[model samples]
Target: MATAAGFEGTLAALPEAKRELARLMLAARQPVPAHPAPRSGAGPVPPTALQARLWRRERTHPAVATGSHALRLTGPLDTRRLRDALTGVLRRHEALRTRLTGSTAGRPLLEVDEEPVLRFTEADLSGFTPQAAAARTALQITESASTVLDLESGRTSAFRLLRTAPDEHVLILASHLAVFDGWSSGVFLADLAAGYREGTGHLPPPELQFPDYAAWQHRWLDGPDGSAELACRRAVFASDPRARRAAGGFERGHLPVRLARGPVARGLELGAAEGATPFMTLLAALGVVLARREGRTAVVIGTPAAGRFAGALEGAVGQFTTVVPIRLDLTGGPTFRELLHRTRAAVADALGHQRLPVDVLFSDGTPPPYDVLFALHNYPAVPLDLPGIEVGQLPGPPARHLELYSPDPAAALACVGLVERDGEIGGTAEYNRHAAAPEDVRGLLTGIEEVLDRAHTAPASPLTPRH
Candidate 1:
């Protein structure tokens, strides 16, 4: 436990290069130019059938479109076979070749082509090292979408083919969060596998294409008579002064620092079947840690929720996520277990309040003084497969950076991003470099882990100190 405490200090003391990385990521978060005549309202705009038919319209930020082709034949890989398969995969996902342009209204727009922007390459894998090939492959999977500044969007997805010492071949598919949601990963993998099999002639038919989902989305978002839910959401939004804030206006700049990535130092998980949903468990854990660190009875953390909770927008998959600020107050009234109950209630209330765009929520003469932001991604359960190969699903990692500042005028602030994948829950803490030592950051995560483990069994005991 004492050693775990030291781990926190180590994180706080990450090298300057790590800090620069954090800064770059932070800069990436600045607001982009607003779209001209952007959809008005807290709710997302509905796309028309014509809009849905366009590949660019369906592609969204936080999800990248990438392509990869691999050959694992009985003999030497047929470059011809690999190239053909790659072309087919690229064609299937039109977004791969799509580009974005700013509308006259300043809104972001998408453009698609039957051909791709970057041409495909077939490297000599038999001679090249795997790591070298992986890195090379990462570079070739170019961006179909970019920010207004022309900086590559901070998202990534990939198609990789590996020859396991001859005779055997494997394809690995992955995408970063910027262009794809966790839910969509499964959909993509499964389809890629099906598509690959069909391309290779092993499968009888390709399952439903993405167009099916787009068609469904257009029908649902557009009112039965042909109008879109956009007008309704817009009406509600226009009436609410808070709805007009900039979409990505949370913070101006970041200081990127890579803490030493060691074994989780400490972590735990809540089973999916426990009837205790992840949201509730996560909130409870967050509340306990923040309360202990700040020595305050209550702490507020911002959570991102899909604002498109209405069934009407189920098929609409743009950037519909909203930020919800949850306050956990543990003043003298309740014990850990009791406070957890309060935490659950607070989370529920905040979800309902999520209708307000963060721009509005923070727009008052004053910004809400919350120091931490935690988002839960319980992506729906789905199957995943890549062409000729089966892809295994693992709980995806959460955002590594936590931008922390004291929400209180009197206190300094620290941020921690807590995420759970598969059943394991762990967090990365971000503290003000000026106010926090590398050791202190490590201590925070260590303390949280101890609190969680001990709390699960001994919920009544005071949290044990690690460092």
Candidate 2:
């Protein structure tokens, strides 16, 4: 395995670029802007290229899908108040009330239904005697999310309640990716609580909506500054053989993996770099293993940078997700420790230019920058406790959620996703069954963890694969 056994000699043998990157990562700062993106029009705005792309894919793959937050609430629940809260949220966020329409003009448009009516269907499934309602809820989450949403009537979201016990029930809030995202889930829960507690239609005013962001994005990209940024980003990523091999090599499927979490936690706690995040450290480990497996001196991995970089859109619900491709240079034969520092620098640079739309990055499929997508899937798990009921949000990517919500299939990615498990961090890898095998994905996962464990112990180790 790669080791940092060499002291001064190894550090002295690094390339100029890598050495500079190491210096930068060691001193990088977490930049958080005080203001949010400005909003303009409140009326119907054009759908984002991402939304349009998803809408087209949904037309063909209607069975593959989004997410269902199946919450089991015990004790008493005010069904009327819950409904009112949800309706109020729908009224506030135009995304929930917006529909994708192509007939409006040559291009697609978001048709907003200001006073759209939504109701939750309740059923007493307590008849499944001796059978656990939680079991039923788990099985139905996939089916519930897979059903194609009717955008024509703006049925982008759905809610169903199954009575499991006199004091226990499952509240499933299913949504399509077109109108929702990882962050949006938390927004839904928070809004629901405010509605139920303060009463519906009584919340504060929402600053912006999905359409406003879309309009802003289009204007930015089409403008001179955006055009220059897009050109530069596109120029950086040429092409690679790894992307081809990943798409056409192995049998693809989901491999749900849970690694021992102590390494990540410890790594973060003991990290010498103050500004570098634990997630970045984890990603750097992932990049090392991937670079080794592919036998490529340079590795490219795509990851999603949330669209909520601006504070204003933080509360607005929409598909505000952006894809960021992180390219790691493993040349100059640097140690794994050096690699981590280098990876951190690369990520920071990418984030600086993340505002450049994903459309420009992968607009044309000719030169696929990356076949692997690595990300820390930090979906917020907000909890709610009302008098007698307790609520929780389920983490996703058991294949069903990723299969339905994963943004473009054109890249044909071998996704490596890290998630929090019982306080420690673990990983979940997924790929199309037609492209990769379960065992293959598992092997990759194991190798990645091995690399991570070793790095956590001593990040300066040489870049040698463990036997």
Candidate 3:
């Protein structure tokens, strides 16, 4: 609905660093013409760009594209109600019932089974000792999480209930990442709890489904709008020479880091003074560290953006995430406060044009623009309250096979993920051992922490030589 003149006026108000990128996006923006409604009966619909990429990678490395969530329930649980809830969730989300049909050699299509049945496996470990039961439950959950889903057969979801005691049970839900994501995990739990409290019959069906999204995405990308968007993205990266370099090979290693509440609070305060969010603040700190470590004036980092900008897509669960490359310019030895403003503008510009699929940016075997990935997991917390049962969340199974099946296998030299819990920030830094040593990776994390401290304590201190 935005006119080109109005849009240009808005971009003109952004920071100087953000102007060019925003202008390119403005050029790509066009009035969306009315299109036919998405195909209803899903015989075989085209997959979203991200889904198709995952499907291809999955074929080469089976069993590696899986995601799972686990919950521990205390107090008596009614078996009938639990079954109904599980069935209701499966019936509600079509992505769980979808399968990839056709040969891998050609473009794959999605097929949804109208009346899919949910058949979850159950285990009773109450007979064993408490510790033994816990160990056995973990083993079972890991096995289930590692199981390769049969995409062609629509066997993409696995649910397991392990009863350690008559009143205690653990529910583990696993599904292919091709059809699921972090946001979907929260949706699944919320829907399940709702269905358990109020019978599934009372719940209204979602206005849209994942298949509808896929169909729409296909049409949009094949049209003039998609072409303009792609061109805009390509121009943004083409202007940056650093973004053209290839990523290093993969050799995964992890290091855990935690920041106390004091520094985190101060950092937040400093960022707020500059009109920046926590993500932008932390990203500025990261930029400082990378600039200092590599001794460069500029750096590019990749971050994931949730593509569920539409209201209808919010409740519909599916893989709707895209990796957006954020480029930072730190040439003038800017203070932490200055850097924060620059980062804020850059992130805003990138996210404004996130609808363009990242895969299309590098279709000719060119590596992803960034070698380091950053993610802040701020997913909505869905609380599950059954009538008399107390539900507690347990850490989900680890993604051990991510290295083999990751769509962007060579795109990341190191990846950093941060999550806030109990007033403290904790995260893991995963690095490619082939490219960086453990000690160096440790030092990089340490540097990030130090930069964060400096940002709060002396916001005006320059990160590099002012001259």
Candidate 4:
């Protein structure tokens, strides 16, 4: 087992300034203790803190937290085999069979069904004209994507197979965000394909299911390490301003932005030169932009982290994404390089203590300190490769939801999701229109781009905030 000396030795390689910064920031926190081992049982377990939060939000907005994907498969397809594969996948992951039970002391609990029931639906539009069939298929996809799941009834996911032609088909997979996360989609697709190509019996059972993780998480939270982590997080956010300045209704607006390969490559090179990753570079730029807009030295932004730190969690299909708040203090005017370093340290500290759930961290029923969310998705890209069929993802409707995991539009003033694909960085900025005007959001994006360009071209130059 690794000791604190080992951790210190690893930190010794970093620059003196960064090492000192990390040491100071993490000095008060205690080392994480071993969590209780997960045991298999059929009893009701307390939902994870994040899941409980989503469950509360679901009371007002039905299906607002649903995540869906549409895929167009063209070629010889086996409908019966696909249905059986779906059933097999459902049986393999307990999250698909989970339901919300009665509240225990104002917190919702989860119960997993012993037998998995596949909620599969099929529609045939092969008799209609080609164009008409396509339109009908699209409509069905949209409906399935928006349909609300009866969480109390243990119906959390819905699947539909639309046969547009004798050789073409559309598959829709939708599930509640409480049980399913972005990472789970890839796992589901990979398992489905495997079950389709081979037999379900050939697939080995997962070492631990989602419920096991949930139960273990609860036990861990009530332990010594969990309490220390929660206290450490509270201290970090204690200095944050409590004023809810941004006033916004629940309506959302979206603006798409793209940077060509040239700039993205240059930005990556700049980050590499500074011993920073792409996310650190972007986060530093975003901090400068927010500081300029808000006219404050302190900046707080929320970013999601994949919570699957344990190797046992890598294959589990469940909600393992946790949002962490990265707070930066730009007290003195610093160059982009300096800001990047600060961001690197802050991100390291935040991620080091990321196991503390957001709901428990901010359980006062008041809004969180940050109003902006910055996400750089680097999820594993698992292709939907079947035996002989051509699989391609079909674009769905524009997402107006501001929050990434929940349907609550007022969760953030502006949410920026960036993805680097095909040598370019492109993403959408979903903002609450009632709080920020479209032009303002557009200008914010423009400022981020300019900051990145400056950092790439001249990283040593000071980050001058526009008044």
lDDT of 4: 0.77
Count residue pairs with overlapping backbones in model 3. 0
Cα lDDT, all candidates: 0.42, 0.67, 0.75, 0.77
Expressed as tens digits, the lDDT of each residue in 207-263 for candidate 2 is 867776776666566656667878888778855542553444333366667766666
Candidate 2 achieves a global lDDT of: 0.67
Q: Distance from true position, residue 267, model 1, in Å?
A: 11
C-alpha lDDT (0 to 100) for residue 405 of candidate 1:
17
lDDT of 1 by residue, 324-426 (tens): 6677767674544666567767877777653344533343344444645555556555553333433332222222222111222112234554456544554
Clashing pairs in 3: none
Worst 10 residues of 3 by lDDT: 27-36
- Rank ordering of all candidates by TM-score, starting from the highest: 4, 3, 2, 1
List TM-score per model, in order.
0.53, 0.84, 0.87, 0.88
Q: What TM-score should be assigned to candidate 2?
A: 0.84
Model 1 compared with the native: what TM-score? 0.53
The local lDDT score (0 to 100) that residue 34 gets in candidate 1 is 18
Error of 3 at 372 (Å): 1.1
Write the residue-wise lDDT of candidate 4 on 7-89 in tens digits.
78867888865664455345325343353235433556778877776677767877766778899999999999998889998
Q: In model 2, how large is the Cα lDDT of residue 257?
A: 71
Ten contiguous residues minimizing lDDT sum, candidate 2? 26-35
lDDT (Cα, 0-100) at 394 in candidate 2: 54
